[model samples]
Target: MVQNIKTNLPGQGDEDRKIRERMAKIKHKILVISGKGGVGKSTFAANLAYAFVADGDSAGILDIDIHGPSQGRITGIEGLQMTINPDNSIKPIEKGGVRIVTMASLLQDSDQPVIWRGPLKMKAIKQFLGDIDWGELDWLVIDSPPGTGDEPLSAVQLLPEMDGSVIITQPQDLSLLDARKTVKFSQTIGVKVLGIVENMSGFICPHCGKRTDIFKSGGGKKAAEEMKVPFLGSIPIEPAIMESGEMGKPFVWMFPDAESSKIMKEIAGKIRAELEK
Candidate 1:
């Protein structure tokens, strides 16, 4: 019965000084999970944070889902309500230039329904990872809530040095056995899978263009080559991505030269070339 899960850092409790200042200015903080729901994994963490800010970089999305946030309607920044600076922190919601953060922006009404549990969803994902304001960033996608509970175990216990994790699956076979239990629960907690995306996977038929496996294609790239990891591709089945997430805009920013937005910008350029190895 090992019980000691104390992690505090929402305002000034300096939890390891704000997680070592966000792993020293964030070169990476991926985390775009999945192991249950409809397996879009917050639409691949909002089109990989809009293809990592349209390739210029400096990104940050962080929805943490909180039992269904959907990155404010998939990055259109739905309702847009967060504003509390006077030193209380948390403002995150810029859009277009990235830096999002959401529980639907601390909701006033975005179809409210947090109905919290598990210590208030682990203190609102530890105040969206220590009181928001993820300033300098190359990437911070996040978007969890699809299994391995308590907001991806409070983002791996408030960033136990996170730098990788992306697992989404929808090629069926029961979503490849729940995406191999989210890749063995991120290798039993060390967290660094960085692969396995296969959302929707097939359905180009617009007037018979063929290719429609519907939900049986490749089985998340053969379950990422039998769970070794690193499949990171396939994302078909576009109906303008459900009309650009019902007009909140996000089929990779309204079909950036579609074909599922060029496979979500080549899956955000193979996750920036596997985070430069």
Candidate 2:
């Protein structure tokens, strides 16, 4: 049987101190969150990190989606275990110019499920921020699982210096409704709402080069306006995005010339502008 990993619970003096010391080295931190799932949030977080790297900044991704950690696969580091230094600090896995810390990397088996409670999940997140040797990074993009729950709440409360959050949603009413809630959640927690991203907004037919509103586009922008947050940009549905995820390659890096990639880069630029300001 695999041994259970013990972590210091939040609010412990030493643990909180370590978290602050480590986070201080990072210039900026961003939380990528969504109100509901299946809106391409994790994928956007990975690509955003890659986008920052492409723009000549050092980036790292902290995947706090403890239950469904996909950054390991999304960043091309699947099945790779994180190592420990002589000092007992955990080392994050580096891939494609972005350092990654995810539960997927630590799992002995990829198929194994993380059956953890709220407190256990919070402890694990604290360990990720405090115990890992992240070094200095220009951006630490945290990919949080959907909803206003344990993972997102823990990260925000821990990283008080976080720059802001990027809410992701599809261009549909249902997704927009939850996305509005996410914006409100960020506001409630005192985290800046950097903007909202509309992913899979439209589909581009490769054969005819015609655009189709597969998900009925424009709801994200409308919601952003209604919520008084910036509307970052919209990403169209492209086949290569899925392929890139499966191949462990970031879509923006793999297909820089593609329309979707361009939009993602533009979104990244907007975020940089906001954070740098």
RMSD of each: 15.4, 5.0
Q: Any residue pairs clashing in model 2, and if so which?
A: none
Worst 10-residue lDDT window, candidate 1: 1-10
Each prediction's TM-score versus the true structure: 0.37, 0.95
Candidate 2's C-alpha runs over 4 A off are: 1-12
Q: Which prediction has the highest lDDT against the true structure?
A: 2
Residue 139 in candidate 2, Cα distance off native in Å: 0.2
Which candidate leads in TM-score? Answer: 2
lDDT of 1 at 29: 85
The TM-score, computed over Cα atoms with residue i paired to residue i, of candidate 1 is: 0.37
lDDT of 2 at 190: 77
lDDT of 1 by residue, 1-277 (tens): 1123324322345664775675578788888888888677877788788877877887888887776787787777788787888877777888778888878777787776878788888777876777776768888888887787778767777776677788988997988998998888887777779899888888888897988787779898898899888997888877778778767777777667876778788888887887786
Give lDDT for model 2: 0.89
